[model samples]
Target: MRYLIVILALVMMAAPVYAVDPSEILKDPVLEKRARAISKGLRCVVCQNQSIDDSDAQLARDLRVLVRERLVAGDSDQAVVDYVVSRYGDFVLLRPPVKGATLVLWFGPVVIALIGIIGLVLFFRRQKKYAAEINRDIG
Candidate 1:
């Protein structure tokens, strides 16, 4: 019984888990592959942090179906992505384009870090000046 349980566990762990349902798969292997590729690059709006391909959310399922439908309608991979982005905005893309609108998303962290560093430097410099004055007065 323990060996059987171990084997089952191993099999489950080895299997690739995807949120995509069999019904969502395209009949054309080529189109299915494209749909999967596009799905991986899209963010799940409901989950926010998970890729649509990995999210089990109902909204993710809808997006996956939409992608397959677009591919079946003969939309190119880029066109399908564009259509989704148009409806959902750039936030749907995991790696949103570095454009004027999204520049803040790309660079906001670095800018914040710079501000923190500058503030720290100013704080330390003021502390050092205050300490020097104290020492002079004590001497």
Candidate 2:
């Protein structure tokens, strides 16, 4: 029983982790490849942190089907991406473009980190000055 459980666990671990169902795959290998490439660059809106290709969310599945449909309907890779962007906005992209609108998304973390570092430096300096005053009074 233990050996069977171990084998099952190993098989599950070895399985591919992609969310793309076999039914959603395109008949044309080239188009399927292109769809997969595009999917990898798209963010799953529901999962936020996961690419649609890796997310098992219902919204991700819908996005995957939409991408395949667009490809079959003769949309270029860029066009398919644009269509999704038009509907879902830049947040749907895994790597959003660095533009005026997205500047906060790109730099907000750095700005916050700088603020925190400055605050820590100020705090430590204040503590050192306080300690020096105490030492002077004690001596």
TM-score to true structure, per model = 0.67, 0.64
User: Model 2, range 11-104, lDDT digits (tens) per residue?
Assistant: 9899675789999999999999999999999999998999999999999999999999999999999999999999899988989899999899
Per-residue lDDT, model 1, residue 108, is 100
What local lDDT does model 2 show for residue 93? Answer: 91
Q: Candidate 2: which stretches are off by over 4 Å? A: 1-13, 104-139
Instruction: Pick out the ten consecutive residues of candidate 1 with the lowest summed lDDT.
Output: 15-24
Worst 10 residues of 2 by lDDT: 15-24
lDDT of 1 by residue, 32-93 (tens): 99999999999999999999999999999999999999889888999999998998999899
lDDT score of residue 16 within candidate 1: 88
Highest-scoring model, TM-score:
1
